[model samples]
Target: MQVKKCSLIALAISAAVSQMAVASQQSEAKGFVEGSKLKVLNRNMYMNRDFKHGQRNGTKSYGEEWAHGLITTYSSGFTQGTVGFGVDAFGLVGIKLDSGDGRNGVGTGLLEINDAGEAKDDQALAGAAAKLQISNTVLKYGNQMVSLPVLAISDSRLLPESVTGGLVTSNEIEGLTLNAGHFTALSNRNQSSRDSAGMKSLDLAGGTYKFSKDLIGSAYWAETEDYFRKYYGNLNYSMPLSDTQAFIVDFNMYDTKSDGLGLSRAWDGEKLDNQIYSLAAAFKTGAHTFTLSHQRVTGDGGYVYGPDGNSTMYTAHSMQVSDFNQENEKSWAARYDLNMAAFGVPGLTFMTRYIKGTDFNTTLSSNGKEWERDVEAKYVLQDGPAKDLSFRVRWGTRRTADIATGNMEDLRVFVEYPLNIL
Candidate 1:
């Protein structure tokens, strides 16, 4: 039944594409077709995780995987009319190169597991969205990727996750942008199927305002039917101390509680109520930036988000492994960033950060403590046959005092090249 439903949707999308293609060829639609843009990205990724203690369900020590991906995107300009119409589409394909002995148990975001609990060799996913533009407002419907303070698409893997829904964005007011949306289904980055069962529809509304060049504020509210409701707000301010020196401050907060049918209460025997907050200060001089931050989670429940959703929390310590979002958890972090361009090495950059977390949930451990360290280096080609090519290396290590299977080290290498196809 699921396959049949997916097939029908695919057919409908194909028909729409055909009609749009024909319409675009007409003289009246020249502007829409000529203004279209198409891009293709080639990405290669390698991931390795070494467990220092405990073990996964089927793995003993480590897991490793490598894959290559191709991502194609097409964005069309609106038709030249009062109510302009356009279409956008994207296709993704991932080819598995290697899945070591622990692939069966490891959930790496690089590939989907088959029914028999083995990783698939390859996967393909695609989506299309229809858009309408009226003055300063735009409306979009169908499958697409969305980013907001309340809900953000996960794109830290072979392919980014997409949602099936409708969204409206308006920027009629100067220095302000408003967005509202409803999402009914989700397609994971590594899976081909769109799943909605057991998941309630998500509704979100948000707005961002720039009060001045150095200050900005944002607020958002979101609710998942029968699941939970969340509220978020953020403030940012920057002060220029000198020509080459500046100080910046950031504050972010989230308040959440169970709503509707109280699904969280029914599933976990506890209401979903939590407040999370983060505050950070940064000092910048020349090409170097230093930052110190703190985050805290209050209440009996942890911060709420989708099971496989990306981390949109405003915490500085949320790394690849853990979010440090357990009940009553508190974390602190220090970070350093350097732009090589200041040293005559343009297109190269380096960053390193470390975070320490403690005071976890009482149900788990009263004095749980964990820490993580991350280092990253990246370079982008400025010009040549491989112009715009990019390479990045990331390494992270985490240690836990009381949690089993939570201590591990991870490394990822990525090579990407983006090309304009049209």
Candidate 2:
């Protein structure tokens, strides 16, 4: 396989500057006690999965579990000064409402499991970060959740993951936001102990720029010790045809290869040298939207991401149950979305999508194939006592010839309510 280097990363950064003036955020800081906020969220979730070809647990062919989560967060405004200082803190807790050794284990990241395979009844963790701001730049240190293109923390499960690190974000340049970070520890979504994933050092640098109201671009570079280094780029553009209609296009690409210590320390022991890209286009008019996308992977091995975070991959086909990522593979997807607000239902929505992948390289079969279908519906109360309460349901079916673990069907239900207190 031939790999194309990401030589344009530097060019993208240099071109991000604009003449637009940006005000200093630190200069207008309010007193810490006057500008603080605290919020809490309650989430209840249930999931069930049926295995058709293989069992996740030693003897069970199906897995089912229910759990409840409580998340509380606090953010304090910077103190009034030339260099403002503040703190951010969070507490997360999860309790098992229903589960057993045979019904739940490694599949669902809702609870912790002991060495005997018995799921723990509860888990909790708390963390905080100290921050300082100067001009339009902020520097933070401690444990926190990060949201960068190359090193994002996964929040799809019951609880979001976290990392211990130091980060610097600069908005000094108008229309451009720059980020740099060094992380040394990781905490999984299910585990309460920090560094549970046993991750080493991870370093990242990136920036995003808004050229106009409808055009944006980003580029990033990341390195994980004893793992792989990755270069990523993204471009998004939107064109308005009318007041209620628009066309949008998004392009994402990544180039990855072995870093120091190379594949010698990789979990799968596969050589790391791959390139992947995805392109998606969508059209919307009124309450309905339609989308189509294509994704391709090439090189010595499939694309890989993280001891950093599982949700770091931002490809178009990164679906609900399957990533559609495999060596020498190509995938295509079609999707439809509908907003019920146009039909007089303000907080209801529906979505469905299908993806097909082919030409995957595997030991069992070189030209393997796989497919997935997913459907989701969600609604939120718009008024009255249960105003901000929401309910969501998702169903997915995945089948493969020789590309994935096995055939599976999954169903998940979530109910959530949030409260604000400051």
Candidate 3:
């Protein structure tokens, strides 16, 4: 294995040198500026009780909040050359503010529970990366976070999502952009396990996010062995219908193929063809707005897959509504958001929504249905010691079939501060 790796490395080096010689390219750095930023974030969450198996069982079960983390980032602005050279540093530390026997994994981090077997809070972790910017483009490596609807970096928990690989973003064309990356390794949200490789995932493809003054769209493709290969796209439009109201419409689609490797063996490896499609629109006036969305999925039974290895159609059309988690399912979501800034509360907001899914297929029971409702509100301290600081509180209730994870309740409170490190 070592010999084969060496051979591959040698081949890559040879190819690189051949290109350098043929083009007679000269290497040099450009510019010379360095800067960094720091963010101290703390999320204190509590649960009134956990709901399970379609019932509010764990009624008397609740208590625990704590996951205070800090992130320090640094970046250098290119060095003179044909292709600019630079680097970025990402340092993270997660401090457990509170925990016990029942709340061990309450917050987030790449590591948890020391050898002592007890949940310990307040510690640290860090990483760095190298970057290069050339001709309206940049390439990054080391701990990275790639964001997309189909592949969004979930930093909603404790630590910001981190990955080890290469990523590139180019905006050579005006109003048009391109993003591509290959992430073969990841250190998910929390827990102290970094040696496991999620599998080699290669991603390529791009699209324009802004075509004119009001039209926008994007598309991409990604593949991870044993997981699935996915391609998805979305288009958004906005228009002013009157002085006080506007219109918004969005359309999206997704196509995926699975590879049986992990606990998620492609249910129907050979004959698997699943696609998700959805359309959503909204009307807004003053401090009030109404949203209506519709989503549909068609495919063999095992067409979608989510967290613990389950099929899902939530690539898009995912809101406070019941998370799209069933194949051959149709779902709908209606939500409302209000900004209280007009009432002298410039930093307060509220949101609520309901979603339902029908025509679910399962073996234990051929037909089933599911639904979810959520309500959330947020307030931000605009000035004084907590300037720009905000807090969000949300509660969600869900009900599903026996085969489903079933009745669920989630409540969370998060606060964060982004400090500039020049």
What TM-score against the true fold does each predicted structure earn? 0.89, 0.93, 0.81
Clashing pairs in 1: none
TM-score of 1: 0.89
Error of 1 at 202 (Å): 0.6
Write the candidate numbers in order of decreasing lDDT: 2, 1, 3
> Candidate 3, which ten residues in sequence have the lowest lDDT sum?
305-314
Residue 392, model 1, lDDT: 96
User: Model 3 TM-score?
Assistant: 0.81
Model 2: residues >4 Å from true position, as ranges? 1-22, 263-268
Model 3, span 1-422: residue lDDT tens: 23433343344334434454232212333254632334444444433324463232233233344667776667666775556677777766777766775544322222356776455665555667787655556677776666654555556556665667666666555686766665556655554344233545544445557987779998876565566667888899999888878999988888876655533432333444577888889899877888999888777544454331111243444643245645677888898989898678888999888888887665534466778888998888888976877788878777776343455666666776766546
**What C-alpha lDDT do the candidate models reach, one value each?**
0.78, 0.83, 0.61
What overall lDDT, based on C-alpha atoms, would model 2 receive against the true structure? 0.83
Model 3 collision count: 21
The Cα error of candidate 1 at residue 87, in Å, is 0.3
Please list the residue runs of candidate 1 whose C-alpha ends up more than 4 Å from where it truly belongs after superposition. Answer: 1-30, 196-198, 261-269
Query: Which digits, one per residue and each the tens of the lDDT, describe model 2 over residues 111-198?
Result: 8887788888899999999988777777788988998888888887788898998787877677999887778888998899889877
Task: Report per-prediction Cα RMSD to one decimal.
Answer: 7.0, 4.5, 5.9
**What's the true lDDT of residue 25 in model 1?**
24
